[model samples]
Target chain A: MIEAHSISFRYHEAWVLQEVSFRVEKGEFVGVIGPNGSGKTTLLKLLYGLLAPQRGEILFELVPMKKMDRRDIAKRIAVVAQETQLLFPFSVLETVLMGRSPYLGRLLFESEKDLEIARKAMEWTKILPFSERPVEELSGGERKRVFIARALAQEPEVILLDEPTANLDIEHQIDFLDLILTLNRERGLTIVMASHDMNIASEFCDRLILLQEGRIYQMGTPEEVVTKENIESVYGCEVWIDQHPVSGMPRISLLRKGGR
Target chain B: MKIITLKKVLTISILLGFVLIVIILISITMGSVKVPPLRSIRILFRAILGLKGAGNETERTIILSLRLPRAILAGFVGAGLSVSGATFQALLRNPLADPYILGVSSGAAVGAIIAILLGLGVSSFGLPLVSFLGALLSIVVVFYCGRQEGRIHPHTLLLAGVIVGSFLSALIMFFISLSQKEELRTIIFWLMGDFSFSNARSILIIFPYILLGVFLLYLRARHLNLILSGEESAVQLGVDVERLKLVSYLSASLITAASVSVCGLIGFVGLIIPHSVRLIFGPDHRLLIPASALIGASFLVACDTFARTLLAPVELPVGVVTAAFGGPFFIYLLRTRKAIRTL
Candidate 1:
């Protein structure tokens, strides 16, 4: 449903993404994996229209991204960025209702229908109980859920996320991945997420794209792309690749260079 | 915006409106010449409705000619300052942002002081016009100096604003030092802010600009609420972030220019009222904007009343009173709300 065609982006003089192109079919769950500074976040931002590429184009279903109205694009594509800081104390409900803004008219307030949608999104994310609580007071994990709920409230066909579980604990990470997988399965939602967790990416995503030095190194199923050689070459880390005992998905284990 | 239930928002707005009416009545009643509150309210209503009343003509003259216009101008100034303050805080995403903080007041002060030196005093329409021009120029400078890659960096903007503000203050001081004794006293009094010069014509001049600016801002309250989620998120949510920012900046600066044009740099009404309102009511611009307007109007009316009557024959500058009250309140807020940081 989304395509990045020969997209190149740079900040000042340093090129962060160079001629990087990819495609995601409808209802596909794709994960972008890369080492630090490999442009994982940059690629996601370019795809979501936060940055205009220097070289090429992004298309949503066939329309050029630049041609589409921002509101129209927003209705179809929601983004859950990394951690957001708010100076004022907005309640969780208020933050979620802001997701409905794209759907609202200039002078119109949120209708009862909008409220119902927001509440349902909150309920699905299990944050309905914290609706009245200030969002600033929430934990990192809970805040991630609130952001996910906000994305759901956008009712978009595709969701883009940048490092959704970067700072999370293992338990929260599993819960977060589980929630995302459930959304993809139940709603047939197309999700493209940038993640640093190779294991989570291998276990959860239908396809993975490994990026190295602002270029796409490989794109395929996890078993096809996440080989020992690929990991070593891209990340400069020696690792052993094995299949998970229960899920039969590829798993990676780090190796010491000279000894144990 | 819907953080509070609709019922609660309605009740609070209605209550604020009532308080505003009571404040206006009391403000017009207490002045150099005392008038009963009931009589003052009756005179105001009769005057507004164009009905003849049996009250003494002196009371009517005092209420209609002097006190009423001063009270109304004070309310307008208060409302304009507070709404613009709220808008700036949201636009810049900094709680410390106000017209004064952004160098807009200093710019306007420079223009007004120049007008005073040139002998174009409060009665001249040119003073407000020049002040508005000066304010617009300062914003342009701030935006130019602070922008990077089409976005205004918060830290750079704040630093540029402070630099510009102090530079303008120095210029104002130079002009003040060059003026004669009478001009110096007049400039200082005007800088401190006094409602005594207010008349019906000044109200007529300020009314439309403030109304238009406030209306435009109120219409964008939802957009501003979305912006509170941070710029990139707001854009992803279809806020048209750049356009919204431009509109908000222009509208807010426009109103600030208007208020500073009429009342020379009333310091704390802009800074304190909106911050206090946000602490009480959650940061939903829909409620925050109008609530700030109402509370600001009433608060200024009360302050102006106190300013005029506190020393009997010698009136304190309304700015002095507001600063005296606002400075400590701001400190209290900063101390109590530990979440407030340099951003």
Candidate 2:
């Protein structure tokens, strides 16, 4: 389990996250949803050890994250940054192989075993044929999959994805989420994903953490946390919440001015 | 894969052979005391191979001492600059960055000029001493000021280098304006760049420093490769990122300063040779660094031949020849490379 205790952070003079706390367990898919500038990314960054908390500490298993070495932390947690802007033309295989960096020896070439692992990861993500192609030449959805392969190659226990579905098409987004769901249920991987799509989060995530202006408004299962009043009050939008008859999960739809 | 590697080796070897032949042919036949290529080789064989009664003394001395040392110096300087340039380009992740952009060249120029003006307290190797000092000081300044938090911000370093380089450049101009007319001519010639000044002693003293730099850079090949992913990635990859960046900046500056101290700035080999090689050879520094050295060496030999013989007896500074040819070629390569990369 990964736990954050009453985390607070102040950037320069302004506070960003204040008294936030949550837990992510093994095999659980927790979705964090918030508006822009609502500190969703900030919280994810803290979880990834990219930023330090001002008031509290985080624990991985039983060890405090601060006490763990970065490389050690990296061995267990993989992060897919929000913007995957690759400035140089690294080949797809080369980019994914970089995930194995923390495990290789200095001045040593990637061994056959390591290459095999990278190949397996690419195959898993279906980016194998593009191994020799420059990542700069790949399309948006392909690049995202390639990045996911890179993260998977790390073979980390916890995967923190910062808006993995952002900028993707509707079909691609669903496909990506389905892949994540498979990973969680089949492999027992702990997933912490942030998304702006409420319906997708409701259908996909095992639990939801609602953040509003840097504070946690609510944290519970989708049915318990996402409600008509909470959506209308927090998001300032009228929403109709009802059970999905098939999945038995809460589903919400924005009520337009005249109809829902 | 094996075939490609073999092909790359064969290609590089052929290019190297071409460079060596060009350097030999042009060095012997194009100097002030010129000789025919046949007699030049004969003379060079007599002196270098120590074959008695093979050639006359004048031809032998001209080939062995004067033109030959000068040619070898050009080759070494060309190769050294390009290698360092390649290293810096890899480190900074910016195609435009070179040892000069770190204020090393300006610093060396300022030092050489000051030594010329103040006389450096000793006549022996005064110019080099001053230039080395200048280069060293600028590197320290750039490394310290160029760094922030834990990483060297490429833009900030570039900006600092520009600021410092301009100040030093202005000072060099100021000194150039103040010196006697005769001294001024020598300074201008030095700045213009010529390989005709090196001797046995100067070469030996400077040789070890440049070779040491090349060795260190070669050793850090993998570390340099890791840096392209950004420092955070480099660190995650088990590299001591800060240390490697510091090493790269210092080592490249060392070779740049040493070469500029002996020969004036020969511009394009550093910027273009590595870039072109990378296009054909890929961005793997292990391959690019060594390949660039050979390509650069041969390139300078050809360029120097042109500098000496294009106008004959009245030698043009190698720098002028390089810029003249390199400027347009660089523009063409850069524009095309950018256009191709976007696709």
Which has the greatest TM-score?
1
In order, what fnat does every candidate score?
0.72, 0.11
Per-candidate TM equals 0.94, 0.86
Task: Tell me, by DockQ, which candidate is best.
Answer: 1
Candidate 1 — what's its lDDT? 0.86
lDDT of 1 by residue, A1-260 (tens): 88899888998798898888889999899999999999999888877778889899999998888888888878989999988877888889988888888899585477888899999999999999889888999999999999898899899999998998889999999899899999999999999989998998999999999999999999999998999999999999889899999999999998898966
Q: Give the per-residue lDDT digits (tens) of candidate 2, residues A42-90.
A: 8887886767898999999989988876667777888776666465567
RMSD of 2: 3.8
Q: What interface RMSD does candidate 1 have?
A: 2.5
- DockQ, all models: 0.61, 0.28
What interface RMSD does each of the candidate structures achieve? 2.5, 4.3
